[model samples]
Target: MVAAAEVVACNEDLITLILLRLPVKSLLRFKCVSKKWLCLISTPNFSSRHRRLASASILLSQIPGLISHLSLNCSSSEKPFSSLDFIDDSAGVKLLQSINGLALGCSFHKLGKPRSYYVCNPSTRQFLTLPPPNAEGHDSFATVLGVYLAFDPSKSPHYQVVCVRNCSLSAAHDRYQIQIYPSETRTWRLCGSPFASPSDIMFETGVLWNGAIHWISPTGATLCFNINQEHLGSMPSPPSDEHWSKRRFRYFGESGGHLHLVEIYGPSTTQFQVFELERDYSRWICKYQIDISPIVDAFPEMVRDYLHPHHHDSLFYAFVLLFVQETEEGSSLLLHIPGKLISYNLRNKSFKEICDSGPKSTKTNTALHIGCFHAHQFIETLASV
Candidate 1:
């Protein structure tokens, strides 16, 4: 082994190429192998190259307690790692959003103290605190609706946090405003004048895609905020009939630089279509047709027959669409079930269990709804927080 190492180490070019292909965890350990390896991997250029080529893994968080890492590319039995443990547990810190490899965390407000926002790289266990939004007298009454992280490592290492808040003009009229915190500036600034957005829209669940943050409302209204131009705009969602007016989208997220939306029109159905937003915001194209009837046949527990009559809104009440992997080879879906995470290939229709949640499922125990869990794509990087 020593002789083999020496032979491979003879050429720095070959050594660098091999190291770049290794996982971030393994590369960190390899750094201690020799000073040469440490110096090579520690360089900014090497880190950037590794980050660009790294495959993304989904980080599943079930609020105050559990956080599981699910890798779609690698078929390993390695246990999930707790990425948010570095933050103080007592602070009631909850992960709001994660982009690239950095996570945006929000801590609950104490008695007199204001809430806190943190940008952290879970891989490095490094974090940075963000300044509070500058709100004067009347604006002080505004409540934060959602906080989102926009970090595209492929574009730049620096990140930006977009905070959407609701401003009340009266008991009848409520307007919304946006505040942005760029890592380069380290201060919060209002993005644009307050505007009236669609009612019943979940602003807090904005998905960053194609240089913009997009939010799809239950009423089928879609809004996007461009980070570069600092402009708010609207986009088109997938076409729907009267039966789909309620939306009932299973997932709306970005993966592999593409925006995807999954809306299950009817209640007790096992089939759905995945839509991809065009780069030009022209229209949503049907990317994949998903039919999980075979999975339900195999895992009878996934059926929603157990739900009470009142709660029987959908057969997917127990299934959560965690992550979707779009690759050149094919596409696959990662779904969160009761006690395990199942990966179903869209191309071949094959499925397998990727991660198990032990005796008591963390999400099932904590979340009133079985589908309630936060999932973010994590790409391992040596980038600084």
Candidate 2:
């Protein structure tokens, strides 16, 4: 009996080590193996190690409540869509942004009024519905500039949810309202205004980097809000040869903890230009200008028949720039072209098609049917909301 117990203890230690390296999704399932195993996997130390080893995926959501996840590694075997079970079907859930494994979701009522906001950890299937902000006078027209999630459960159990509201104060002027909700306090309060003048914050392409949330204004300036300090700042955007009004196909994103700007232009709409902000955010440096002519040349039939000659004029209505992945293999850009997803590798100058099979069939879909979809960088974590 003594010898058997010693062997069991040794096996348990070996199992724990092996499980620590697995992804959070697998660990969540393994928790049902035994009570002892559940306790081990539920530890803070185990959760931290699991997060470090896990890779980030891309979460894609379509209008009218369709959510899916795609692996960032571009694994073909991965399912195109993994349904989010935590969200209720009746509730109209719209994902705002994701940070440190926690996603901020805005749920609207039947009449389209601003409802409650939920911070959810999709991997762990845990979520917390935050108390609604004080919206006494603010109505549905109050533009939600952006919803930022400031949570890292690994460091501390507490988290914060910030909502940037831009409303019309006058015909020519706008008011910026900053609302903050801390987990510890469980209450929402108006922090303060972050902008000096009436500025239109681009919420669709907001990127969180360097402990701040950034958005590009119509004037070609990057608006920044420090999450920790709750202060606002502005930085210059990338230089443009054409007028600011003429340059429309620009997106703000982050890669390798650095902010990047992607501008797609040219007559054929095959020119891809990427810029990286300096460490001090003073100026922008042109990283690369990839000519996608090789890709277009490869598929001459598709380019000649399907590709629009003047796509650059209405790029947003046609194509969406998905997440950018910088890996050991190479840097690649994921782009949503109508019904299909294409990946362009910067190193090899090659383009590969990605599969997008969701709950409904996409074989006969078109650009109009695909509509507007949101994609975010998603990392699996055992963090609680």
Candidate 3:
């Protein structure tokens, strides 16, 4: 076999072929191959290509799987996830940004590792690298924690990105700090807000809809920030969960053309309660206690495969994605189990694993948190295991 170092110096096509076959671990090491390869892997164009491949969506593969997916795009797979797609794992994810298929990451071996680098489709065998957002004095404290990359579908193809930071609340400061980084400008603009701070971890378990990014605050406050409008505010709160261990950001999304949040019982981690915010300021309630676990009583043999296993690694924590799905009777949502890219139907209350048993070479786990912008794109932590 050709040495990895020699492979990097080869022509682009050969390098791309080798990358497509290697797993995440191998890709990380390949970064040292050469400066050019490093630069190539870090570009925005490569990210878009990578997204298309790993999702391996057939544009038309009739996998009885994702059948439970409540996505509005549930029809034929003919259309790609739209050309311009921006994906980030959590609202609190500062260092990672995925836009138009490219994932940008902040790399710092020293003090604060701000969002500086970007990773393309490690699976697509392409990538691009951009300079860090800023090389300022506060580079130690300024962090790109949460990201929102969006393209306007109503108008011509257009996209924007927002990188937020929570600075310290000193005597001179009362609210948290936020920063906006638009791809069109390639610069960071500082904006002080009514709420935000460096120490706070804005819960990712909120909703992103109508041009705003939402989050569940640590103290149970429903928080939201508008990326286009550049404003911070709060949404209405629901009743408390009796169980505290499960007291994390549950799933929040827009369904049937309405804003919604799903609250599940903690500890039990089985039952899910749905809350929909209405125009008049009232909530629509729908609750379903799902033991999607492998408990035989919960699911029969026919649908057993839909229930996948989380890695046995004790260090890893698993969070289930429960979003609103559309149903024939009314409207519904489904739960997306990590590792297994399948969406569990809330209507039938059944799960369908996308059974494309092809070898997948992904940059990160499939179970990343869900967002509103597009499919297979969500906010995730950058600190690798």
Number of the top-ranking candidate, with lDDT as the measure = 1
Q: For residues 1-385, what per-residue lDDT tens digits would candidate 3 score against the true structure?
A: 5697666657697777666554344555777877876776655455334433442221111121111112333443222222112323222122233333334333334344343444443223243343344424346334445544454323323345555543433546634556665555656667654364323446433345667776665456566677767778766666666656334556656543467666555333344566666654454454544555542233232122223335222222233453454434554343334444445555565555545322231114443343311333321111110
TM-score of 3: 0.52
Runs of candidate 2 exceeding 4 Å displacement: 1-9, 23-26, 72-81, 140-143, 153-157, 167-171, 193-195, 243-246, 300-318, 355-361, 366-371
Residue 287: error of model 1 in Å?
2.2
Worst 10 residues of 1 by lDDT: 358-367
Model 1 misplacement above 4 A: 1-15, 18-39, 77-80, 108-113, 138-142, 169-171, 306-317, 355-368
Better of 1 and 3 by lDDT: 1
lDDT of 2 by residue, 1-385 (tens): 9998667666977777889777677787989988988999998888888777767667777766567776544565444235444676356777777776777777755665546667888767777877656655656324565677876655686788777776555646666677888888888887874344435557656677777778886556667778789888877767775743645545677766778787755434667678888878878898777676665565342243234556534333345566676666578887665456667887777777765433243335644343466677777778776
Clashing pairs in 1: none
Q: How close is every model to the real structure, measured as TM-score?
A: 0.85, 0.84, 0.52
Which pairs clash (backbone N, Cα, C closer than 3 Å) in model 2? none
